[model samples]
Target chain A: MSLDASQFEAFSASELAFLAEDELITILPRQNLSRMDFKGWVQPALRALRRSEVPLWLAVILKRQDRCTIIYPNWLDATYLKTVLEAEGRDSASFAALPYMWQELSDTILAEAAEDCQGSVAEIMRTLQELKELRLNKLRQGVLVNNDSHLRMDGIGSAELNLVKPILSKTMRTLQTVKDAQEVETV
Target chain B: MNLDLESIINSVGRRGTRTRAEYTTAPAQRLKQWWVAERMAPHLLEYQLDLLNEVITNCRSLRDYIEETSLTLLDEAAVESLGEETLRDVKIKLLLVETELERAKFVARAYKRTRMAKIDLLPYYYLQQQESQSGIMSKDEWVYCHHRTELEASSYYKGFLNAFPTELQGLTDEDGHISMIETPDMDKPVVVRVNTDIGTLKIGSEEVELVKNGVYLLRFSAVSDYLEFVDIL
Candidate 1:
């Protein structure tokens, strides 16, 4: 079914079903997939398909999931920063903190949430760390900063380090609390 | 329900792609799958024509309800308010409620739009099934799981990033290969390779040059998509 953009328009529920058959993502079944928080996957998918230069605000309604899962893969790619810099006619490397801002937000939220949760705390903490690690690695990888001069700003000039500090403190406290609770339970 | 509405109901598709053959040809398969669609087609048509009639009646009732309630509230507040400031506060509260009502109406409009979207998708599904070698499914039988999957892998990922904004961090290069950035003394350097089904975290000083720290998150995505992650040296 080679359909033009016009043809793809005005889909009925049944047409949506046909589209589902062809276009659905094949992930691990719900039982296995249940172990992870898949709600975080939405942004990367949207970014990959970002053709419109003007950013569009997404309002997602998941069929299976109750909450609207908004994924921001901004932490995964630095193109957004480069785009902003290019848009401003600046050197671009100066604003490498764009993606890091996103990472810090994720880490902050997760760290806060992990404060009380017991069962999924470890997993969530791991995920947040992974996000942080990705951002740091991306910074050090130095993909955009052409020369070593641009790299000089590196970790020192992040728009997100302030946000990251509080998140780290919260995460540490939560981990300590959880460890204490575990020890008390053992006793 | 009346003859005039019935006549109009039968006439809607005539202006579109309904040919003489389509009108004359009996849809036997449609009878089996969408017995309700065929049987209720006439009733549905009648309903469509009378929709305006029902809507008009509803609007009249809503108007009457609003007028009655607004007048009652206004009179009650007017009698109770002793000071000008109190009256002003009452009016502000009333204005807030009115604003809430308008907001609710906007939500209702959006809900109707989504309902219309579902309704519009129906004909496309019908046309697709009609042309298929396999038999058509009933409206109730239709599922969008597969499409949802594709959407999740692509669109959902992007939407998630927008809302949470941290799913993707720190990528300055896009050279088709994954790149890892090394940070001194950062211990939890987990190397997770997708397609190989492997995960290794650095425990000691043994340095593993990474394509990037992003390999772990990508591994998560791959794993979420049910792909194996293989750790490569």
Candidate 2:
């Protein structure tokens, strides 16, 4: 049976959570921290030095414990994002090559480590939100322009793909309807 | 088992009412039926059902693998060789397995819904006959029958019962004097096409040879018992 909207939403959210767990985040240890053996990553040295790379889920845990500080990546930097947003001018294609989990990871880090971060979490969140909206708009535009039923947006994570799947399906259906109407008119 | 037509009718009606009520608010409850009737391709349902079973088997195997691996990780030698690449590979595989399990679960739910819908459509007398012939009733069918009886006095259930063959009514003799049909054994021997070499299997007293790309008939019981070894065509 066709999955209803709510069922689909739940499925998408769960799949997104699984995807977001693998996303990498840089963290700076405030003190020497022993590595916790988990499924996702290679076990680091017994004592992690000042800086270490960890999955977003682990980073959030470390941040919550005040064990480390999250390092915001260059792409997530306010100035850099603003520049890309301006240059791309609402084109998702340019941003398609960007990290798939960038938005989700940034938002998560901002929420988890808002108190520990040096800058305002709200400001970074705003910028990230804006970038996400722009990218989504571009994705929608791409879907409308493409005739194929499948909308293949490279570099989009499973979470993002699930989020926009319904919209893409609807767009494809609308396009089909329009094409049918035009053919009938000509005939 | 003796067939109770009245009880069966009542249960069917009860179930149909409950299902109808549930369907009003949550059509997803009938998703499998909808998928079968509208979305599924011809013969795809059988494949999907097989795929669902395969996925379940894989999930169980993966779980066993994880448990075994975790125990191995406790070993000093195993821990030492658990390099970054190995850990990453395992994690990726586990993630893929989990995703596949989730998809399989969705398929399974849809499949169950379709079966329930089929049982709902069948009249109580027909369902009873099927149970008698098969010597078994699926749990879903039992539940459906129980619910149908709850709606027994309703006009809807009466309408369904009325559509059954008039001659069949005489077959439900309350005195236990109804003659039993000599139905063929369900465990009768059947032929199967071997897709892959499965070596040999013991069917009753004989050791049956199974060659790759070979066709042979064997008892249904034996074939079902070793379904993984051969494909039933």
Q: Chain A alone, TM-score for each of the models?
A: 0.23, 0.70
Encode model 1's per-residue lDDT on B155-224: one tens digit a residue: 6556564565453532222345653322111111112333442344332222222232233211112222
Docking class of 2: incorrect
The residue-level lDDT of candidate 1 at B138 comes to 27
Per-residue CA lDDT of model 2 for B38-119, tens digit only, reads: 2211111222343345545645665666667667767878766888656644554444444434543554565565445444
lDDT of 1 at B122: 46
The native-contact fractions of the candidates, in order shown, are 0.00, 0.01
Top lDDT hit: 2
Worst 10 residues of 2 chain B by lDDT: B38-47
DockQ values for all predictions? 0.01, 0.02
Off by over 4 Å in 1: A1-187, B1-69, B73-77, B80-82, B121-233
Model 2's A-chain: what TM-score? 0.70
lDDT of 2 by residue, A126-176 (tens): 776776777777766654434522222445544555565545545554655
